[model samples]
Target: MTFQEITKDEFAQFSRQYSQSFLQTRQMAEMLEKRGYQPYFVGIKQNDELKLAAFMTSLKVFGGLKFELNFGPIGQANEAELASFYKGLKAFVADHQGLELRTYPDSNYRTYDPKGEAIDQPNERAVEQLKSYGFDFVVRHIGFDEQDVVAEWQYIKDLAEISDEETLLKSYNSNAKRNVKKAIKNAVSVRVADFDELDKVEKLIEGTGEKRKFATKDLSYYQELHQAFGDKAEMLLTEVEGKAIAAGVFIEVGSEFLYLYGGSDGAYGKLGGPFLLQHTAMLHALERGLKSYNFYGISGKFDGSDGVLRFKQNFGGYITQKLGEFAYYPSKTKFKLIDILKKITGRK
Candidate 1:
């Protein structure tokens, strides 16, 4: 088997034939590039058949960032093929002195076992297999049942065949309506900023990180997104008393309106700044005829009862249990050493 890197243009060509989730799309990768991430691709071919492939996107930290060997939209391959692909991947990255290569498949492999049957919840077999390869498993708060209330609002496009406003409002929880009204009473303004406002939007993100104890990318990163996505991307900012209080940047990827990055001023939380910002985005999505509004990346640890989960529930979205990282680490010595440590620590 041969593994080779493809150009961005080449990857774009491959995307059409092979299906991928929004995260693996070139647009999303470009979004990450705007945030200064280094993205690359690797494909395995043997005698004219492209049997397997992977995406490696690196975030270079001063110390070290978690490097992932993401499987992209391709779910579980034939076990033998996947194993061979993993071996080649391990060899190639090891030669290049790669650090912690995590495999986060774009598909939700955990939700369904190898036989393609939905288990009661996430399967433990795949998690155990990856662990044997010296990979850490994160049993985080990220799973969702399709029948749950949050899932109904999230997958509204599927909840009912109709897109009429009256029908949709009936689907929303009472609390969601109350928050929307509260945001209006607070005089919070939500509008999509033009691409020219990238600078201000970037500042909002940076300011939000500082005030809320989160991380942010450089301003130039977002500027590039506006240049690339043009009108397809949007930066929504909310303000009160002429001060920027809340901001979120989202992109319409395929049928899903992804909630990419969001932040709000700590002082404005009580004023319903974020509530207004999110509600306005949803309305804008409806206007554009989008299928669903995804409040992305909830904690996998939170049960159906957590306040944070309840907050997202107000948006009326569904929970999707996405597969986490998996990888095959070479170096028998290092692999075995880490395996012992992990077994003793009982940490994934």
Candidate 2:
């Protein structure tokens, strides 16, 4: 197999063979580029047929650069093909004056049933294999944020079993069903926001952040995401009697639809805009023939402390925890220095 950088069209064409998150797409690369990440589409091909591929975002860090494979390197290849791809990827990074090559290879160490019981054994072999390839699996339980890159725990709803909307609504927990109904009965409306209304979307997200005491991305980031994904992205706003109560950014790609970002003002919780907003996203996903609706993050803990987890659970989905993150440092000295600097600067 030969390893080389490919064009966006090549990457997009090959990527259709496997399911991937929006983060692994050229659109996401373009969005991240606005924040200073140089994007590269690297792949391995045999007989001019693509075997393996990764969409990497590079940023200067410390003295060298850091490359991230957000949730991919998507393709159906054997362990041998993967090992060869990893070797090529490391060399490519090193040649580019890279400090580290980080990846989150879309694997799960554990997956839980709806009752929160572990149904799959831990992925010890994949962990060991990655470790053998010089990538250290970093143990972390951080929820999805800029620091975490992606969620370790994701709450996902499967839409395949439902034959109709009634079945889907019946599958929701009582709380969710009631809330969605309440929103409808209250004459609350949920619809896609106009492109110019992105600022309103940002305002709703900011309200959520202030209420929940968390940070939110600037409006420009959300706007850029919408621009990148075009019609595949929707900024949904739920309003009651002409007053906006909640907003969410939903994107559909591959076989999955995601509630990537959301925020709400608590004053109208009784009107159930948040619940209906999510329901609308799921309905759109089902309509698109998507397989799954990703409610996104949760802390890895299943002990039920996370309100976010409870909110997602109300939609009746199983919890999954991916294998998390791995990093290969081409320069051990620089890696250690950066670690020390992070500690000193109080950065995670």
Candidate 3:
């Protein structure tokens, strides 16, 4: 087996034949490039056939460099092939003199029903295998903050099970049903916004971020995102009386529709524009024959008063807890020093 850097076209062609996350897409690579990260497509070929591949993004840190593999290392290789791939990955990191490599491999740790009962067990064997490769696992409860590479817990609505919109609405909790109705009564209409209307969506996001005390990316980042994904991305906005109140960014990859970002105005809370906007996105996903509509990340801790979790639960979706991030430090001393410096400087 030989490991080599592959072109974007080669990566895209390979990606089409395998199941991968939207983060692994070439468009995502392009977007990351605009954000100061250098993206590379690395692959292992056996007998001149692609075996395992990953989309790696490298960023320069104070001490050395950091490599991030977001929800990736995508391919259907056996255990031996996987071990060989890791070996090559380690060598690649050494060649680059990277301090650390972070990866969030797409693994189903566990699944929960709508009632929050665990319906499936975690893949402990895979976790153990990764640990054997000297990868340190960061076990975090879902949704506290994305201090890790990605969120561990996700809310996913199985659109494939629903026969129609009416059936889907019926699946929602009573509060969600009422809110959707209220939005309709308040004349809150949801529509797909064009690229020109992204500024309005960004404003809505900024407003919500201010209220929630969270940081938001600038308008240019969103513009680059829209340009990269093109039709695969949809910006849904809910409006009342010709004024936008709520908006969300949804990305469709294969059979999955991911609700990536969302925001709304507090003044329109009574109108329930957020709920309507989500419903509109889900409906669009259903119309497009998508199998699942992902509400994305949520805090793992569940309580009635947790508004964010409650809002997602009311939409009637199962919870998916992923195997969290794993890190490989080429030099432990350098990695620790970098971490300490990052903490001292408040750099994330």
TM-score, cand. 2: 0.94
Q: Clash number for every model?
A: 15, 0, 0
Predicted candidate 1 versus true structure: per-residue lDDT over 76-104, tens digit per residue: 36766666666666666676555456666
- Regions more than 4 Å wrong, model 2: 143-149, 213-215, 337-348
Report clash pairs, candidate 2: none
Residue 171 displacement (Å), model 3: 2.0
**Model 3 TM-score on a 0 to 1 scale:** 0.92
lDDT of 2 by residue, 1-348 (tens): 888999999998888778888888888888888899999999999898999888998898766788888777788889888888888989999999998888887877888976678988988898898898889988755543433337667788988786567888999999999999999999999999998888989999888766654457888898898889998998999999888899998888888998887898888888999999998888888888888898876766567755667788898988877777899889899789888998898864
The candidate maximizing TM-score is: 2
> Where's the lowest-lDDT run of ten residues in candidate 2?
140-149
TM, every model: 0.70, 0.94, 0.92
User: What lDDT would candidate 2 get against the real structure?
Assistant: 0.84
Candidate models: Cα lDDT each: 0.60, 0.84, 0.83
**Candidate 3 residue-wise lDDT, 1-348, digit = tens:** 888888898889898887678888999999999889999899899998998788999999778788988887878988888888888888898799888898887888889986668998878887888898889997645444453226677888888888588998998999999999999998899998988999998999888766654446678977887899989899888999999999988898878899877899898799989989988888889888888998877667665534566779889889888787888998888778878998999876
